[model samples]
Structures are given as structure tokens and as C-alpha cells.
Target chain A: MSPQHRALATREAILRAAAEEFDRLGYDAAPLSAILERSGVTKGAFYFHFPSKEALASAIVQVQDDTWPRLTGQWRDRGLDPLRTLIGLFEEAVSLLSRDVVLRAGVRLAADRDVGYPGLSSAHLRWEKVLGDLLLAARDAGQLRPGVDPEAAARTLTSAALGARLISSATCRCADFPERMREVWRLVLPGLATDEWCPPALEVLAAPQEP
Target chain B: MSPQHRALATREAILRAAAEEFDRLGYDAAPLSAILERSGVTKGAFYFHFPSKEALASAIVQVQDDTWPRLTGQWRDRGLDPLRTLIGLFEEAVSLLSRDVVLRAGVRLAADRDVGYPGLSSAHLRWEKVLGDLLLAARDAGQLRPGVDPEAAARTLTSAALGARLISSATCRCADFPERMREVWRLVLPGLATDEWCPPALEVLAAPQEP
Candidate 1:
């Protein structure tokens, strides 16, 4: 491998190992030695790539951005029906909750006081705007209720998705998580649509997919 | 003073002192010696009232329950108007958030992983049931719209409240917290309410209360 390629691989390995450790033990309890051992990288290589544990944590926060877009970015702007796009996003997230232990642990770890992860806050700002823009488009298309507040709906919907994820982690079971989330969307979407429209296959929306 | 009267006063003082210390420095960081000094009670007196720091922390948690009841516990059985009750509860919580520093800090401490505070799980359980019961009552009363799942809504609402509180603490300027929370309520309530019911005063419900 080229020197640059080898360096990139080492960096990725370090972040992957750090993500798991931080998730399992939180930022405060995670030891640098353990991360080093897990990644099979020297202290020199680790410091060459990242200066401190907090820096590694900051990288994990960035990794989530890449992860989601990789998994579901294609759904966005794919010219699919907007409702379908939204349902697809929820399905993908629920799938990750059940299938991706690292991602799941990363999320719960973000809630810890010490981590101070800004990953979700950044995601919230961008996603809320995207959702708001979509809802506004649907409103102009005469597909949504006249009085629906797109920004507010977007905010609530985002919180609902997150709320489901939180519960899924706490219960250690996603058996009820997807269905419960769909129920929230079912209630929300009808109230949002102009003619009290209900999505035909709410069950499909609740179907779990492999991450 | 009677022996019983003296013991009660001393216990209350220790709880107050410990809460202040815990609120300031967090559960793990706050020292028992500091609490004793602040309360001006002997170490023997403190031990007599509470067996361990965990016991003292539990007392602090009890103090939290004692404070919020008049402000929040009133949401139960205030008639069948879910939208109104929902609005009322959010408004009350917001009002409390603005005024209650110790309660706010204590909750943040409870959520902290580094503290390992044991009272948080129990407090969350109590909160979940209370909120769930209220939502269930609303659904039964037909105030909530058809297909609106009470359990999901309750969980979502609780998460939203938690996220909002955490955000407010991090941002340190809650001037808009209540308004934002009201927007959450506004977005969800119409979906949850029956057709016959239009929310009584959405603007009023969203507005901050008079001092």
C-alpha cells in the first residue's frame, strides 16, 4: 500500500476502536491504553493521527454524519414521493438500532454528560431545515393541511424518531420501537395532510430492515 | 425542643445542604464534609440521619419529588380535555423551569453517567408512569384523535421535555425554552385532539405565565 493509504487505514482503525470503547465505558472511563490495544496501533501512530481522547470523541461525532448519508443519503433527492422518503429514513434508523451495536452505543453515549457530543445538535439543525423545506413543498403542492406549521412538525417528528431510539436502547429491544414510531408518524402525517390522508401500508413502514 | 423535633430539623438541614452541594459540584464531586460544614451539623449527626452518601443522594431525590408536585402533579384528572391538559402541563413545566434552579441542576446531575447516581432510574420510572397515565386518559376521553397512540405520545413528550431541558442547560439561555416547548405541544396537540375540539388558546398556551 502507498504510505498515504496505510496512514488512512490506521486512522480509521483507531476511530473504530475508540468509538466502541467510548460507547461502552463513556468518555471519562475509557482508557487510552485500551483504545491502543484494540486498534493494534502504537502511541506514536495514535498521536500522529489524533492528539487526545476528546479529539477521538470529536471524530466519532463526525463519523455518524458519514454513516447516515452512506446508509440513506440516496433516498434524499431521489425524486421519490416525500412521504416515502420520510418513511424510508425512519426504517433505516430503526434498522440501525437493532443491527448496529456500535452506532447504537454511540448514540446512548452521546447523552452522557462528559462526552458533550455535538453530533446530534448539528444533525438536528440540518435535518430540521431539510424536513421543513420538504413539508413546505408538500404544503405548496396542496398535499398538506393549510394550518400545519412545517418547522414545528419537523421538530416534533425529529424528536419522535430520537425518542424511539432512546427507548430502544433503554429496553434493549426494538420489538415495539418501530411500530410505536410508525404510530406516531401515522397520527402526525394525517394531521399534516390536507385531506386526512393515511399512508396505505403503515405495516411496511414498521418493517425492520438489515443495516 | 423535643428530641423528635430536633432530629427532624437537623435532617431537613442536611438534605438542603447536600442538595446545594450536589447541585453545585455534582453527586460524585461533592464532598460529605462540605455538606456537614454547610449545614453546621456534626459528622455524627449526619451519619445518624443517612447511612451513606447514596442515602443522602436518595434524600435529595425525594426533595425533588416534594417540590414538583404542586407544579406538575396537578395534570391528573383535570377533566377530559387532553389538548387543554397537555397545554396546561407544558406551560406549568416551563414555568417551573424558569424558576427552579435546584430542581434543574439536580435533574441534570441525575442524568450524568459519571455521578452514578442511583435515584435517576426511579425518578424516571415515576415520571414515565405519570405522563403515560395522563395520555391514556386523554385517549379514552376521545379528546385525542383516532389512531393517535397514547403510549407513543407519552414517551415522545417525555423525551422532548428531557431534550429541551438539556438543551436549555447547555445553551444557558432558556428565554425561548417555553416557547419552543409550546411549539412542540402545538404541533402534536391537533393531531391528538378530536375534530370537534380546536385548541382553546394556542397563543396563550404558548405564552409565558405572569409572575
Candidate 2:
């Protein structure tokens, strides 16, 4: 590997180990010594990548934030309609949350009141905005129910998705995330989408997709 | 005041102040000294009531658990049907969560990955059970739509309600709880309830209550 590539690899190692520590313990309890030990990286290398535990936390959240837009952009490029894009976006999130430790840790840290990283809650607001914009497009495209409030629907769906993560992880360690999200969209789409769009949206959510 | 009354008051004071500190600073950051200063109780008196900070955390969660049953029983005694009963319960919870610091602290602690207290997650499981049983009763009473999964619906609603709390507090410190919950039920009930009951449940959720 090139010098820069090796450096990137070391940083990834530290981040993976740190995310595991944070995911297993929380921000308050996850110590730097353990992260370094688990990563098998020297103290100098660890400090070179992350100055503090909070910095590691910010890195994990940054990874998740970057993942969201990229995934959404990919789905958007598929030419799916707005309502379908929302469904596709949620499906991708549920799948990623189940497998990605860094993503799960980012989510856990965001909800955790202990983590003081300033950038944490912004992810949630960004997500709500993303959902809102999609719902607005869905409405304008004649896909949403006539009385559905886009802003309220956006926040409600965002909250539900967030809650789905919390309950799923707290209980089954996120093994049930996809099923939980499927149930959320099953109920929500029926009320939020127009008659024509609701059934098809439900069908898409009910149908399984390749990860 | 009588000696017994004085002791009770002191304990209540410690609990209130501790809950305030926990609510503001989270579990790890909330110091007993700040709680003591805020409660205006001596260290000796504080120890007399709560053996440790974990005990204080337990007391807050206990208060919330006790309130759930009492509030639910009161609503049940009003002879509400199963579906309406669920609506009434969630509405009360939303209102209570907005103003009750102890209750909010319990919720915060329950979701906090840092808190090691064993009792925190039982509240969530208990809540899921309560919602499940109610949905089951509603199904048995022919109040549900065809093809609705009661267990999934139960878990879905619990997750959504839990999510509403997290988002509300994260953004607006829970002033938006009522509005958040209203949007939740508005989106959830239409898909979960039968044609006859869905509209009325939405009405109850939408109409302002006496609280």
C-alpha cells in the first residue's frame, strides 16, 4: 500500500475498534486504552487519527451522515418516484443499520444523552429534512393523501424510523430492524399515500429487496 | 411538619433534584453534589433515602412505572373500548412526558446506553406488552382491519412512541411531544384500525383533552 493508503488503513482500524467499543459500552465508559488495545495500533498511531474519544464518535457519525446522502443519491438516480424513493431509502437504512457497526454506533451515540459531540443531532435534523423533501415531492407528484401534512409526516416518519432503531437494537440487537421498518411503512404508507400509491408502496415494502 | 412527613419530603426533594440533574446532564455527568445543592438536602439525608445514585435512578423509573398502571387503570375504569383505551393511554403519556421531569428522566435513562441499572429496559418491554394486549383485545373485539398484524403493530406503535419522545426532547425538549404523538396516531391508526373505529380514534387523538 502507498504511504497515504497505509495511513488511511490505520485510521479505519482505529475507527472500527472505537465504534465497537462505543457500541458495546457507551461514550462515558469506552476508554482510549481499550480502543488502542483492540485495534492493535500503537498509541502514536491512534492519537494521529483520533485526538480523543469524542473525535472518534464524530468520525463514526460523519461516516453515517455521508452514507445517508450517497445511498439516497444512488436510489434517486434509479428513477424511482418520490414515494418509492422514500420506501427505498428506509429499506436501505434498515439494512445498513443491521450490519454496519459504525452506523449503529453513530445512531446509538446520537440518541445517547451522554455524548456531547455537537454534530450528532444534526444527522437527525438532516434525516427529517430528507424525508420531508421526499414527502413534499410525493405530494406534488400526486402520490400523497390529500390531507397529509408533509412537515408533520416528515417528522413523524423520521421519529418512527429512529424509534424503530432504538427498540430493535435494545431488544434484538437490530436483528429485527428490517421487519420493524417494514411494519412501520406498512401502517404509515397506508395513511400518508394516496389510494393508488398506498397499495403499491405497501407492496414494495412488503416485497423483499437485495441488500 | 411531623418527622415522618419531613423525611418523605426530603426524599422527594432528592428525587426531584436528581431527576433534574440527570435530565440536564445525563447519567455519567450528573453529579450527586449538584443534585444535593439543588435539592437543599444534606449528604446524610440523601444517603438515608437513596443508598446510591443507581437507587435514585431506580426511584425515578419506579415513579414512572407506578404512574403507568395508575393512569391506565383510571382510563380503563372509564370503560373505554380496547382501541379507545390505547388512544387514551398514549395521549396521557404524551402530556405527562412533557411536564414530568421524573418521567422524562426515566425515559431518558431507559434509552441511555450508559446507564447500567437493570430496571431501565423492563419499562420498554412492559410497554410493548401493554400495547400488544390492547391490540389483541381490539382484534378480538373486531376493531382492527383485516391483514393487520397485532404483535407487529404493537411493537411498531411502541417504537414510534419511543421515537417521538427521543426526537421531541432532542429538538424541542419535548414541547412538541403532543404534536408528535398526534401525528404518530394519525398515521398509524388509519392502517391499524377498522373503518368504523379508525376515524373516532383519530378524533379522540385530535381533540384537546382536559389535561
Candidate 3:
């Protein structure tokens, strides 16, 4: 392999190691030495890639931020209704959280205040904005109930989703995330969507998806 | 003051100090020395009341556990409808969380996993049971809509409340806790309650109480 290709590979390996450590033992408790050992990379290579633990964590958050827009963009391109697209985005997020340790670590780190990563709240703020925009679109399309405020609904839904993920992580290691999210949408949709939109929204939530 | 009263006051002071430290620095970073300095109690006096940090945290959890039942019991004794009683309980919780630093600290510590406090999940489980029972009573009273599962609804509400508290704590130092919780109920009640019960539930949420 070319030198550049090898360099990229080494960086990726370090990020994976850091993510696993952070995921297992939180940001404060995760030791850099353990990450180096797990990656099987020399201390020199580790330093070349990540100067500090915070730097590694920040990189993980960046990757998470990058991944989200791409996933949502794909759903947006599908030309589905705004509400369906919002559900699709959550469905995608559940999959990513379950499949990607780096993403999960990023989320956990973001939720932790002691991490001191400004990027953490930025990520949440971004999601809230995305949800708000979608809800506005849904309202314009007559999919939303008459009295529902898009911004308030967006905040509640976002907070509820974050809360569900935290509970699932603590209680079941997220094995039940999809089911938990399904229940949240089940409880929330009737309140947010117009009567004509409720059946289809429920259908979207009930449709089978890969875990 | 009597000897018993003095001892109780000292114990309470120590718990308050520990909670402040824990709330500011998190569990792993909060040092016993900081708590000691803040409480102005000698090390010997501190140890006499609480043997260890974990022990202290456990005591805080115990205090929090004790507080909830008394608050809920007050509402239950009022002989209000179950749904109204539940709203009153949440309103009381909002006040306790805002007015009581120790309670806030206990909640933050309980949500934290690295604290290694076994009592944390127990606190949450106990709350879930309380909410479940209240929801079941509401269902029987015909307040809840048909096909709503009391256990699942209780879990969702509990998780949502936790999530809202976390968000409020992060965004506004919990200054917005009551407003955030009100928004949560405003969005959730419609889906959970029968149409006839919706206005009364909203009214209960909107009613102001002494904090």
C-alpha cells in the first residue's frame, strides 16, 4: 500500500480503539495507554494521529456529525413525506447507534457535561434544527395537527429520543432501542399528526427494519 | 440544640456539601477534601456521619427515595383523580429539584454510570413502579385512552422526564425545568388521555403552585 493509504489506515485504527475505550469506560476514565494497546500501534504512531484524549474524542464527534448529514440527506432524496422522512431519520439513527461503536461513543460523550466538548451540544442543536425544519414542512403539507407547534414538538421529540437512547443504553445495552423508539413514536404521533396522517405515520413506525 | 439535633444537622450539612461537589465536578472528579472544605466540618466528624463517598452518595439516594413517596402521598391523600394526582406529583418534583440542591445532585449522580452506585437504578425502578401504578389507576378510571398499555406508558413518561431534566440541567442550569416538563406533558397528554380528560389534564399541568 502507498504511504498515504497506510497513514489513513493507522488513523482509522486509532479512532476505532479510542471509540471502544470511551464507550466502555466513559471519557474521564478511558486511558490513552489502553487505547494504544488495543490498537496495537506504537506510542509514536498514536501521538502522530491524536495528540491527546480530548483530541481523539473530538475527532469521533466530527465523524458522527459527518455521518448524520449523509444519512439524512439520503432520506431527503427519497422524496418521502416530511413526517415519514423524519421517522426514517430516527430509524437510521437507531441503526447507526447499534452498529457503530464510534457513533455511540460520540453520543455518550456529547451527553456527558464533564467531557468539555463544545461540539457535543452543537450536534444536538443540529438535530433539533433538522427536526424542526421537518415538522414545519409537515405542517405546511397539512400532515400535522392544527394546534401543534413545530418548534416545541421538535424539542419534545428530540428530548424524548435522547432519553429513550439513554434508558436503553443503561437498561438493555440498546438491544431494545428500536422497540423503545417505536413506543415513543406510537405515543407521540397521535398528538402531533393530523387525524388523516396518523395511520400512515403509525405504519411507518411499525414497518420492519433491520436492527 | 440537643445532641441528637446537632448530629442530624451536621449530617445534613455533610450531605449537602457532597452533593454540591458531585453536581459541579461529577462523581469521579469530586474529592472528599473539597466536600470537607465546603461543609466546614472536621474529617472526624464527617467520617462519623458518613463512612465513604459511596456511602454518602447512597445516603443522598436514600433521601431522594424518601422524598418522593411523601410528596406523592400528599397528592394521593387529597383524593384527586389519578391523572390530576400524577400531575401534582410531577409539579412537586419540579419544585423539589429546583429548591433542593441535594436532590438535584442525587439525580445527576444516579444518572451517571461511572459513579458505580447500585442504588441508582433501584431509584429509577422504584419510580417506574410508582408511575405504573398511577397509570393503571388512571386507565381504570377511564382517563387513559383505550389500547394504552399502562406499563409502557409509565416507562415512556419516566424516561421522557429524565431526558427533559437532563436537557434543562444542561441548557439553563435547570431554570427551565418546569417549562420543559410542561411542554412534555402538553405533547404527551393528548396521546395518553381520552378526549374528555384532555382539558382537565392540561388544566392540572397549567395550575400554578408554590415552589
- Of the candidates shown, which would achieve the greatest DockQ relative to the real structure? 2
Q: TM-score winner among the candidates? A: 2
Over B162-195, each residue of candidate 1 has an lDDT whose tens digit, in order, gives 5554444445534556756776676666666676
Q: Candidate 2, what DockQ?
A: 0.45
Over A9-120, each residue of candidate 3 has an lDDT whose tens digit, in order, gives 9999999999888876667778888999999999999899889988999898778778899998998999999999999898889877877888888776765543421112
Please give the distance, in angstroms, between residue B190's alpha carbon in candidate 3 and its true position after superposition.
1.1
Residue A4 in model 3: lDDT? 100
Per-residue lDDT tens digits of candidate 3, residues B63-91? 77678889888889999989888888987
Error of 3 at A196 (Å): 1.6
> How does residue B46 of candidate 2 score in lDDT?
90
User: What TM value does model 1 have?
Assistant: 0.71
Q: What's the CA RMSD of model 2 in angstroms?
A: 3.2
Clashing pairs in 1: B145-B192
- Per-residue lDDT tens digits of candidate 2, residues A1-211? 9999999999989988988887766676788889899999999888888888888888887787688889989988999899999888889888988888888887667645434321135677788898999899999999988888998998888877777776676566677889888888887777898888888888887676666
